[model samples]
Target: MKRISAVIVNWNDKETLARCIRSLQQQTHGDIEIIVSDNASSDGSQAMVKEQFHETFLIENPDNLGFGTAVNRGFERASGDYLIFLNNDLEFAPDSFAILVDALESVPGIGAVIPKILYSQKQNAINSLGVNIHCTGIAYPRMLDEPDCDDLAPEEVACGGIFMMRREVYEELGGFDEDLFLYHEDHDLSWRIRLAGWRLLTNPRAVFHHRYHFNKGKMKYYHSEKNRLHLLLKYLELKSLVLLAPPLLLVELAQWAHSLMHGWFFLKLKSYGDLLDLLPRILVKRRRLQSRRAVADREIARLFSSDLQISGVQSLALDFFLNPLLKAYWLWIRRYL
Candidate 1:
């Protein structure tokens, strides 16, 4: 039996942590170990886990270290053949871990395998089947709102946050990039895994329910914009970057304008400004990432689909502006390209 370590990162989510752990305890797979990394939550999250789940390996950080760093800490302590980085707000089905373990073990070259994630609030709705990226390096969960629970075959990517992977691969790729702080680290790792010639997969038979958002605010948007650009600079070659620039610029401009219209001007400015502020760091990291590149541009481009490319910009425009502007922008992209 292969030993698996499930690493769950927690912030101030005291309310959801118990349920998450309960679901883990119910896993039929007995060879699993639970590692909880707490980010110095003031809300007694650490105490609750310590008092209740004695089997869980708890790593307490003195300060609120970001998600990427916390998970990396967990990786250092994980002693399993397989490592699973899961969110604190997610509840796994009884066989979720077993199925993921089976998938990774069954496939020879697969570096990682993710299960179908459903919404905890809307049980029928899907959270992520598989993650897809665009030429611009924007990544999103495929089939975000889709209801179908069909089984999906193994496919390739670089890294996924809620996925299982061989411990060797995690060490070889150097684990998640702590610089990411919170968002887009998964994409960065996944991209690196693919470039290193390892396959990342999704197993539909395994399932987990995610709370999705126990907290809501502009912080998410800020981290999102900051991280998206970070990954783009870190992964894409100059040629692909040049090709993707126009669409990305257009999308950013539309987002800025929409933010102003919605009286979120400061939030919009902050998002772009965060990117600018970290420009030096991003460039330095990009050079470092490029040095480790194994896969070529042709291989990376094959991972993206045409529909995925258009949909990202389309969704952004629709979310910020009205539906009419989205249609117009979509039409413009179609005509110009």
Candidate 2:
């Protein structure tokens, strides 16, 4: 029998951490090993897990290493045929992990499985169905904040917050890019795994509740934009990059204007500057990715959208003007690639 390992990376969120652990304890899958990778929380999250969840394997770090690093640390200690990475702020339905495990086990070439995630505060609202990549190299969670429905199907990439992967595949792919630090780490991993000929799946029958918030600030924008650019730098094939460069520049200009309006202009600049500093390492990683690529650029391009569809981010003016132009440009470039 294939054993399951659940890894939860936590920080200062004690209440949510305990709640998440309790939900994991309720999983229908029997004797699953749970590992808590606590990132030096000041709120006693480590002690809470130790006292209340004695069965859990705990690794309390001395200092806060970012999300990707902590997750990597947890995976290093895991001993299961299938591994799950869960957020401390999530609560899984009793059968969620069982369903996910079944899906991956039954499917050939599936690298990971993500559960349908709905907002805990508002049951009708979705936190993520799966991720959708854009032509300009941005990735957004599909159906976010949309009314939850049972009609959605499997997608190209799993939701980062709630997902499971085959242990061997995860190790072979080198797991999450710790260089990403936090944001867009999933996309980087997903893209690489897909390139290496593995599919990411979604199991609608498996569901979880996420305590999500819009919570945006300059630092968030900085990491998101910075890591997004890093994803493009590290994975995009040469042909795709050349094809998408013009539109990417246009998008960058729009982003600069938006950031200026929101007093994040300096942060945006800092992201660009950071990318420049990180170029050498990015190029080395890109070479390795390109050399191992199994999927062609054309196939990957088919999965990318030319226009942003998520609400609040899309404007009537952008849809009316920018979106059309981007779509037309993508149509042109994608054909030749």
- Predicted structure with the largest TM-score when compared to the true one: 2
lDDT of candidate 2? 0.82
Candidate 1, superposed: residue stretches over 4 Å from native: 157-161, 214-216, 308-337
lDDT of 1 by residue, 1-337 (tens): 9999988999998878888889999999988889999998999999998899999989999887888899999989999999988888899889989999898888888888888889988958988877777554556787787885565565565446577889998999888887678778788888888877788888888998988863335566567767887887777788766656666776677657655665566876786777787888878877876887788767766666333332324464455444444334434443222
Clashes of 2: 0
Q: Model 2: how far is 94 from its true place, Å?
A: 0.5
Clashing pairs in 1: 158-190, 159-190
lDDT scores of the candidates, listed in order: 0.77, 0.82
Worst 10-residue lDDT window, candidate 1: 305-314
What's the distance in Å from true for residue 89, model 2?
Answer: 0.8
lDDT, candidate 2, 1-337, per-residue tens: 6789988989999999999989988988886999999999999888888889889999988888888888889999999999888778899889988898899988888988888999999957888877877888767777777898878776655224357888987888898887778777777777877788888888877989998877576788889889988988887878778888998898888788778888899999999898899999999999988899999878777777666653336567577877788889888889877
* TM-score for each predicted model, relative to the true structure: 0.87, 0.95
The Cα RMSD in angstroms, rounded to one decimal, for candidate 1 relative to the true structure is 4.0
Tell me the deviation in Å of residue 165 in model 1.
1.3
Which parts of model 2 have CA positions greater than 4 angstroms off?
Answer: 155-161, 309-314
- True-vs-predicted CA distance for residue 59, candidate 1, Å: 1.3
RMSD of each: 4.0, 1.7
